[model samples]
Target: MAVQQNKKSRSKRDMRRSHDALTGPTLSVDATSGEKHRRHHVTADGFYRGKKVIDTGSNE
Candidate 1:
């Protein structure tokens, strides 16, 4: 079985894990809906950027 030869120091281990922290998804405000949504993604109402890209058919 493979095993670690030396004990990893806490500082070194923490430093290595510095980049492992989870980051929140990037969100952007929709110009048409004025709602926050993930970047490059359409809003719940099918609005992308300032234009309507999809017809959700919720009006009827």
Candidate 2:
């Protein structure tokens, strides 16, 4: 078993854990569709920045 020879300082520990906190992805609502989607990402319907670029086939 490995043992710690020295204690980790508070500042060092905090800095290391700074990115450990869970955070929800930043999302923005589409003005046209009124749907919430992540920034810089296309909506489920394949729309990006208010433009329909992809053809999401209908699930008929």
Estimate every model's Cα lDDT from 0 to 1: 0.90, 0.92
Span of ten consecutive residues with least summed lDDT in model 1: 27-36
lDDT of 1 by residue, 26-54 (tens): 98988887899999988999888788889
Error of 1 at 38 (Å): 0.4
User: Across residues 1-60, which tens digit of lDDT does each residue of candidate 2 receive?
Assistant: 999999999999999999999988999998779999999999998889889988889766
Give the clashing residue pairs of candidate 1, or none: none
Clashes (backbone N, CA, C under 3 Å), per candidate, total 0, 0
Work out the TM-score per prediction: 0.83, 0.66
Task: Give candidate 2's TM-score.
Answer: 0.66
Q: Which stretches in model 1 have alpha-carbon errors above 4 Å?
A: 58-60
- The CA lDDT at 56 in model 1 is 94
TM-score attained by model 1: 0.83
